[model samples]
Target chain A: MANTNASAVKKDKKITWKEIKRQKTLLIISFITVVYGFIFCYWPLTGWIMAFQQYKPKNGLLHSKFVGLDKFKFLFGDDVFIKVIRNTFCMGVLNLVTSTIMAILFAILLNEIRHTLTKKVIQTVSYLPHFLSWIIVTGILHDALSSTGIINDLLLRTKIIDQAINFFAHPNFFWPIVAFANCWKETGWNAIIYLAAITAIDPCLYEAASIDGASRLQKIRYITLPGIKPTIMILLIMNIGNVLNAGFEIQYLLGNGLVQSVSQTIDIYVLKWGISQNDYSLGTAAGIFKSAVSIALILVCNWWAKKTGEERLF
Target chain B: MNTKHIKRSLEDRIISVLIAIFMIVFITVTLYPVINTLAISFNDGIDAVRGGIYLWPRKFTMKNYTTVLAMQNLVTGAKITVARTVIGTFTALFANALLAYVVSRKRFLFKAQLSFFWVITMYVNGGMIPIFMLYKNLHLTGSFWVYIVPGMIGAWNMLVLRTYMLGLPDSLEESAQLDGAGYLTIFWKIISPLCKPVYATVALFVAVGQWNSWFDAMLYNRMKTEYTTLQYELMKLLSSVMQQSGSADTAKNSTAAITPITIRSAATVVTMLPIICLYPFLQRYFVTGLTIGGVKE
Candidate 1:
């Protein structure tokens, strides 16, 4: 049987080509997948070679004059690059911490509600903003935060401040706005995974805890938190890779000249130089660095996950 | 015992009230901005600039929607967006499912190599410029296929689908194999039906991604009017409105019935209309499918 062959081949852990030849049809079918991976996923990697050269479109990838380490040198030397890195790191961490905490809190609280109808409605409504495009999300943010808009209008009525605070024009408020926008958009969507993990937790654990007179908060603290911890860790590990991403749209959409210093993430920088400025080589250099960091973060997280005896996303 | 029961009931009542309050706040905060945008979009543009529209239109008019819906490019953009979402989602699903099916079968030679090959992609990248250049080189740019071809096999979604397929009993596959079925037959007849939930989830992910994407159109299909997407059109309108605030004309205009604000809001609403309408129906599948995270194994 093919099953026995598969198990036997797997156990042998050697080139049992004769056994595999029996399933040659499957291998031939998968050859397309192999070739597809090279063209799309692996082929672009060859373009990384452009990072080493002063890449020119006219000359193309190969014929472009090679300037060894010059792009990286210029990138690292720029004071603006340092600021970009800082803003990305700061905003990334802020988003990660705030969104994760808010999502976990929402998930736990939603799970506590015994009424199914109310729970379903709230959960359904919570997912609305996540589904909206970032342009739409930022459009809402613009209207809500404009000088004569609701935030300013409310502030005037409540006398929080005598004058309207221009939210986007200021640098200090930019990071918080990005963080809040991210939370507003993603909290409910992210909580779905946590809630799913919670649902997977055995109901018997709860009944046992109840019999032992475990209070509601105690039950959450003892059972629910621990139960969802692996999901939390795995998600965290997965998200760590995206920490550098900081997303191009939200930053690019909400970011303006006034807050450019604070808002230009590495992604935006790549767009500004690579795509817009036509400094493809420098952009590739910056992107290569970003990819390097992302890969390193993922590897380190996987290592830690393995060390902690938790499910690691390799 | 009776005292403890009363105490417990009181605590439950208090917690329930608190949760209700929290949920009310959550719903309001989530819905207010959207509803406010809706109001501004409906209200007369001239009056909206005066700045009191919150939950409802002050001076109701259909002019904003009328003006936006009348744009020829928006219509074209809508066609392209719809085409891409449908075509992109189906192709990506098929391609990813095919590759995932191949690697998921343990009996397939080079299973680990094929899977980890794709999985490694999820962790790293070739950088954007290179990929863009690669697409350009391959003549994928300036065409509709640009949107579909490069993204046909998303590493992340394929990985998730493979993980879901792995959860199915091996016996289902083995029995199908015993019946003289090949890999494709086994995948179509046995595995595909069982993976409906995950497929739904992946489809939603792809569809929404395609629907919401404008950057591709901006990058590859920029010069082509026929290939422009709805999101890109809206983005153009939004950015124009956003950047034009520095000019005095936009601020000085007090008489126009159609202002940039109303136009922008209306276009945004129109762009988002399809996905928002479609998601509610697909919600049942994705919710169940996503219960198993990206990497369940």
Candidate 2:
């Protein structure tokens, strides 16, 4: 028995050497990647330490005086910051609800369409906005919402309003405009997932419902709805974490003094206070706050998903 | 024919007709804004400002395109954008694919550890300031390398590619190994060629992302006007248009007959033209890519 164990150990050692020799290239690649991970990924995480410091560029992070929670206190104390948070949350929820509903509705409508050529064309046209840069979308939005643009012209011609409405200039319209813009841009692209999920539903289930004299609406309700529920649940759970990422580009572009009250998001605030003002610690603290809250939201949502036995990101 | 099958019901027919109308409205909804912009771009600058142009140019002119295209900023922005898209996409694809291949290797000793190391980045990050400061420390700020270097590997794409790699038959690698092919040889000669479908998918995604990205340009190279992207240029044109509109009476007395509306619309069109042109060819790949990524548990 002892001799057999000794031979087994010897064989394992021999294989280790041969394996190492064979894996040399892979090892080198892994080493480079690991180094990249350290520099780009891990390094920034370490730099989050500056969030606690009264950081000055001259003093560097290590030399900066540590100031615990002062930046947080200041951020919470600021009325503009609170308003920014409100705008962010409102836009975020609006975008999420509208885009998700539109995607689902569009997918269902597309599924009902029988003409292959028409369906193909519509699907192709729909995803075009998803590919467009926010810069381009914002440009389109600016033109369309301009005082003399088609929307205002139509409203005036229909006597919906006696005069042209500068949609972008109205603070109250900001959140809805952002939501509608997001829905327009993302609905088709987002619908692709639901369409895919719909395709994966068992055809037998539909047939079974049909044989039972289920109407079109009945079949859709009994099968299609339940079929994509998991996908919907998972997507919702995943997006819960993104409630703060209400976007920076569109808001920055479309927003002016007129709608700034409703347009400033947390990211914009970070850019304004953090990078633009050269207040490193303050920005870092705001960023840290955002990251913490986002992480907490994701965790709670994930835990709830597990408890409910619903589809979850984790 | 009537006797061969059950006749269509009124409700189904009505519902189908309603769906068709809804689809038509959807198409019009998506396309009208773009068509309006195109019309504005082609209209005479002063004519466009009078604001009757809806779907077609009221007074047709090519001057807006010609003049905006002639600007040094647009030319430089276009050059930088194209260079970034081509170079950034290929290098990032290669880096990401390599990392994906490494992690997807079933028997590689460090596969799980390395995969975990990269995956965590998707969930948590040091946030904007830390990364901005990090780039400053690395001297990537105000440099074109800022676009190429930091984006060399995207964790999400790497994971997607890794998933694709794992789906490939393991025997391909095992047989190659038996022939004494090194990992590099197997990766370059065997894995990458076989990975063309996924590679194309990832490449399209990365290229489009690089082409449309202006935030990076705004952050790292805003002051370096020569290094700005096409999208950034469009953004600047937009803001300038807004500023001019605000001070239109003063601007009307000073310069050429050009109006901000024409220039802005032209810039918007030019910014979107490439993607619009490529959409027909690229949509299928992106659709497939999305489904593959989306459906995976």
lDDT tens readout by residue for model 1, A1-314: 88997678577555587757766766776788778888998998888988999888999887999999999999999999999999998899899999999999999999999889989889988888888988788888888888878899999999989998889899999999999999999999989999988998999999999889888888999999999998898888778778998667899888989999999989889888988999998999999999988888888988988988888776
Residue B213's lDDT in candidate 1: 90
Which residue runs of candidate 1 sit more than 4 Å off their true CA positions? A1-21, B1-11, B247-249, B295-297
- Candidate 2 segments whose C-alpha is farther than 4 A from its true place: A1-17, A310-314, B1-5, B247-255
Name every residue pair that clashes in candidate 1: none
Looking at candidate 1 chain B, the ten consecutive residues that score lowest on lDDT are: B288-297
How badly does each model clash, as a count of residue pairs?
0, 0
| Colliding pairs, model 2 | none
Candidate 1 Cα lDDT to native = 0.86
Q: lDDT, candidate 2, residue A154?
A: 82
